[model samples]
Target chain A: MKTLVSYDIVEDKVRRKVFEACKDYGLTNVQYSLFFGDMTHNRREELFQRLRRIIGRQEGKVLICPVCDKDLRLSKAIEVSAGMPEEAAEAAVSYPGRSRKKARAG
Target chain B: MKTLVSYDIVEDKVRRKVFEACKDYGLTNVQYSLFFGDMTHNRREELFQRLRRIIGRQEGKVLICPVCDKDLRLSKAIEVSAGMPEEAAEAAVSYPGRSRKKARAG
Candidate 1:
């Protein structure tokens, strides 16, 4: 299934762990706290379980959603970084940790 | 079409204006910088143009995407505020600006 995971984590450390978990699951980091990609039902469940454990007693929320191709086609993404000086800044803004990287599955 | 809009604006003022525009378009505040709801192609284009103009000469990025019912069903939202005191805090974190009121949508 094509899943979209988004979260609002308070603690910086906790948030980092969540990001790592998403990355480990082969999900693409689309935004600061938003991840997107495909995952098997078992993988999604495993991720949810891990995220639940990781988020224990933390003041935060993690949302995992699905995205079909039909809706995704209608999707729009607008990125404006023309004001930045270096090309790296735009890449950094667009993809948080994968700047200058070739690409990953999304 | 079912549309999803997300933005990362630099200036607080410009960000607020963009938020107002999204709210004016009847989009639901699903996250801090994400909005979701149904909108015509024309409306989406209009929003894109307005956001583009608002973010001119500024460091920001606004993305508008689509979400269909099939994908929406597989979505999961988990909120952890059991340790927090007062109901308003949860409301504030989950849905900013629209606290203690009936929800517009998801």
Candidate 2:
């Protein structure tokens, strides 16, 4: 499944930790406080737990939204200037599984 | 369906318009540039179009992620000190339909 993770943290140290954690999970940074990635159900759960530990009981917030591949394909992302990275834009538009197969075939 | 809308805009005027558009759709502001709301599939589509119009060809980004109620219930939201508004927190944890019924019964 594709997931969109967004966060807002006040503490600088904690915020950096959170960013590193997201990257550690192989997630793509779409924006400053936003990330997107493809992960299995189990992996998603694990990522959530890791984030919770990093966040602890601090003054911050994280929202993990599970986006359906169908909805994602139907969704439109318009970039005026140099918006998201190529990889992030690809993740948003294409189904990861299918795209991986295409990559292999090519 | 529950939707998590997140945005990052460089222009002040466009950002304010996007914020107001989300509120007009009866969405709750979870953070400065993030919002959460419940809407039907059709309404969600309409909201998307409106956001696109507001964004136009500018240096802004908007991501609307649809969240399943079941997944939302399983999701955990922890607030340290005044994290999210009470309403936003409730939306994250409970099934909207069941919660509405409970409210009526009570």
- The best candidate by TM-score is 1
Q: Could you report the DockQ of all the candidates, in the order they appear?
A: 0.40, 0.30
What stretches of model 1 exceed 4 Å from their correct place? A82-106, B82-106
For model 2, residues A1-106, the per-residue Cα lDDT tens digits are 6777778888999989999998998999876688888878788778877876786666777766666666565444434444755554333322232454553342
Candidate 2 clashing pairs? none
Docking class of 2: acceptable
lDDT of 1: 0.69
Q: Could you tell me every candidate's TM-score relative to the true structure? A: 0.73, 0.71
Q: Candidate 1: deviation at residue B71, Å? A: 0.4
Q: What pairs collide in candidate 1?
A: A75-B66, A76-B65
Task: Kindly give the stretch of ten consecutive residues in candidate 1 chain B with the minimal lDDT sum.
Answer: B91-100
